[model samples]
Target chain A: MNHIFSFFVLGGIIAAAINGKIDVVTTAAMTAAGSAVQRAIALIGIVGLWMGIARVAEKSGLIDKLSHLIAPLFSWLFPSIPKNHPALGCILMNLSANILGFGNAATPFGLKAMQELQKLNNDPDTASEAMCTFLAINTSSVTLIPTTLIALRASAGSKNPSEIVGTVLFATTCSTITAIISDMIIRNLYRRRKYN
Target chain B: MTSEMLGESFSWFIPGLIFIVFLYGHIKGVRIFEVFIEGAQEGFIMAVKLIPYLIGIYISVGIFRESGAVDILVKLLSPILKVIKAPTDALLLSIIRSLSGPAALSMTMEIFDTHGPDSFIGRLASTMLGSSDTTFYIIAVYFGSVGIRKTRYSVLLGLLADFASFVASVYIVRKVFL
Candidate 1:
């Protein structure tokens, strides 16, 4: 994060100087925090709504049902994990929420799942194979609906805003499959070697 | 049914999910209302905690955009993108989407404005935007919260997924929409 942060700031400065876009740089820097705050504020309502629903989902035992539904698939994917582990439930909830396009709702569950997985980690500093796999899958999660994309397309005046849904689903599924496969390969490849 | 057809009824999906949960909780003898409030509170607090990180990343991303660094990167990567037959217009969106959501949205809007929404480039951009998460920002938030400094191969594999999504987006768009 630090390295990437510095690269953005320093690279931006150099590029702005070369491109003579100093005004844009100054303006953007000035409003950056304000814009970010606005975004966070906008997020509050959505987060609250989804988190509430997610909580209800948890209490309702839907999460358990979801875990059971995906248990076979989870077992195959996360062979290192035991069947009834808390991480398995959390992972199932997170992935289900993600598929529903409930990103805000998925995040807390994802964080909780990570914390649960961390409890099983032998090394505290390095991410475990399960963590890496989970992260990869979460990063490219398949969604049943691409709501934001549809909204964007609609606002842009597309006659068929949902036209790309099939493509998005297909593409995300491919990426998810690739993420899982590569994660497994990388995990095994680096298993014998110690990463410090 | 195709997802597009499902999209037409997407409005009910969330409410249906919530109703089902509420019903289940009631049947299971859980305090649905109280639990919902508790989760909502946590969500609010989480949003508050995210402010600093969000501001920091957004500022950096804004600076990156204003400075034209992304433009330079896109120009440099365009040859490779061309070799893969990705629309040149989507180069920035695919690159930035994994870094920052808002930045990628801006790029998507730019593409939509220039290419028109129904155009092949516009649809490709939209599909790519939908398919991937902001990997770096997610890693920073999730791992930083856990105090894990050594990320191992998470970043590499995450980028691999993003790469796969980008390639798949291009191919699928060509096959389905073109």
Candidate 2:
């Protein structure tokens, strides 16, 4: 993040000096900060509402129930995870949170899942296959309803804030499948090379 | 056609989700209202916490744009973007989506402000943002916590997913909206 920040800032300065747009850059930097706050303020209500409901879902065991629904597929994805193991449960919870787009809820469970997977690892320092798979899944998890996204769009005065929901679902499904398939193929290749 | 049908029903999706969540909570004997208030307070805090990151990203990206740097960069990548069917404006969001969440959000904001959120690029940005996660951040935190040194295939897998989602977002958006 630090590097990205400095790059954007210094890059902008250099480009402005070259283009003679220092005045425009100054004005943009000034208002951009103020506009960011305004956007965040506009975001509070909807994000709050969604988070509230997400909490209700979590407390009600709806998240657990949803995780249970995906348990069969979960087993198929991480067959190495022992059946009914704590790691499996943790992974389910994390993936459930991700699918709901409750990122704040997802992170803790994800970390816990990684810890459990580490417990099963042959080497503590090197990532195991399960850990790699879990990492892949989390990074490209399927999000069904991206609450923050819809909120941002609505705040931006979108004609239809939820209109992209279907597209997101399809796109994420494709991405997740791509991640899984590529991980499997690469894992196979690595194993072959190691044995050969 | 199927996507269009699904998109059409989205208006009721959130309302239904909320109703189900509350109803399930009630059935489970959970204190829905109290829990909701508690969570909403956390949400408010999250929003406040985001202010600094948002300010930093928006200012830099905004300056970058006004300075005409973004245009030059976009032009350099325009050929690749055209081949991928991604809008020139939404390209940064797609790349940044895998790297940083705040920066991607700021870029989306800039895109919406320049091209109305209902525009093709705007919708493209939203779909890309919604579908993808921050790959590098996920790898760092999850692997970092577990003290895993060799990420091996993780980086390749995560980036492949990110790239696929970007391309899929572009194709799916054009298919559904255009």
- Give chain B TM-scores in order: 0.80, 0.59
Residue A120 accuracy (lDDT) in model 2: 90
Question: Taking the tens digit of each residue's C-alpha lDDT, what string does model 2 give over A1-196?
Answer: 3555577788888889888878888898998889878867876675577667767877887766655666787788887876655677668767877987778667656765776798999888788888888888888868988878888998999878888888999899999999999988998899999899
**Residue pairs of candidate 2 with colliding backbone atoms:** none
lDDT of 1 by residue, A75-191 (tens): 898988777666888898778778878787687778667767889888888787788888999998678787777878999999988888889999999999999999889888897
Docking class of 2: acceptable
- Model 2 scores what on Cα lDDT? 0.78
Cα-based TM-score, every candidate: 0.86, 0.66
**Which residue pairs of candidate 1 clash?**
none
Off by over 4 Å in 2: A1-71, B1-77
Error of 2 at A115 (Å): 0.4
